[model samples]
Target: MLFIFGISPKTVKTDQGQFVCPICKTRSAYEIKTQRNYFSLFFIKLFPVSKPRESAVVCLNCGTHMPKMVLDH
Candidate 1:
């Protein structure tokens, strides 16, 4: 019998919009992402291995990820 299983991290985009990035210092397109660890079988994701992490706002222009608090400021 052959068995292969592992845990893998996956990042998914949950939302998209425009925001003023603190690092980029300009309004740009952004993607809201959530990262989660998933159990994989033979390179196929089966189930989540851990809780979903806090969402991060990623800037498409400068490729920087910032906390949601940046939107409040």
Candidate 2:
């Protein structure tokens, strides 16, 4: 059960394939991935970390960005 509910910020999705800059509509963009590793402490039991998920986001044009909240299991 605990293994299902993970972290924040899911993946990157674009409406036009290329993310449009909020300020200007342009194809120019860049990607950045964030990786993290940590141990989870619980009162019932001690669990081992299986794998670290790669959370990412991209800035389309104007450098404006939003974080993805949920993901499919």
Candidate 3:
């Protein structure tokens, strides 16, 4: 039997997201530029999907690092 856990695969539409940088420990935030698919190829290597579902948020300041997911409904 396949073990079922966590939220199922789905596409959530939104216009914004938020995250706090660990180093700065400040409310550093950004805006979602587009919607993309989340992928997990072999539990060991999980990351946002590439191609077709290609979209990302861009930091207004430093243009580096991965984007933060909006966890709260």
Give the candidate order by descending TM-score. 1, 3, 2
The CA lDDT at 30 in model 3 is: 56
The global C-alpha lDDT for each of the candidates, from Candidate 1 onward, is 0.92, 0.42, 0.45
Evaluated with TM-score, which candidate comes out highest?
A: 1
Q: Candidate 2: worst 10 consecutive residues by lDDT?
A: 64-73
Give the residue spans of candidate 1 off by over 4 A.
none
Candidate 2, residue 3: lDDT: 52
Q: Over the stretch 32-61, how does candidate 2's per-residue lDDT look in tens digits?
A: 445444343442223334453555445645
Of 1 and 3, which scores higher on TM-score? Answer: 1
> Per-residue lDDT of 1-73 in model 3, one digit per residue for the tens?
6643332233444455555544444455655554444554333324445432444554434544344443232
Candidates 2 and 3 compared: the better one by TM-score is 3
C-alpha TM-scores of all predictions: 0.91, 0.29, 0.31
Tens digits of lDDT, candidate 1, 1-73: 7989999999999999988888968889999999999999999999998998999999999999889888787
The true-versus-predicted C-alpha distance at residue 37 of model 2, in Å, is: 2.5
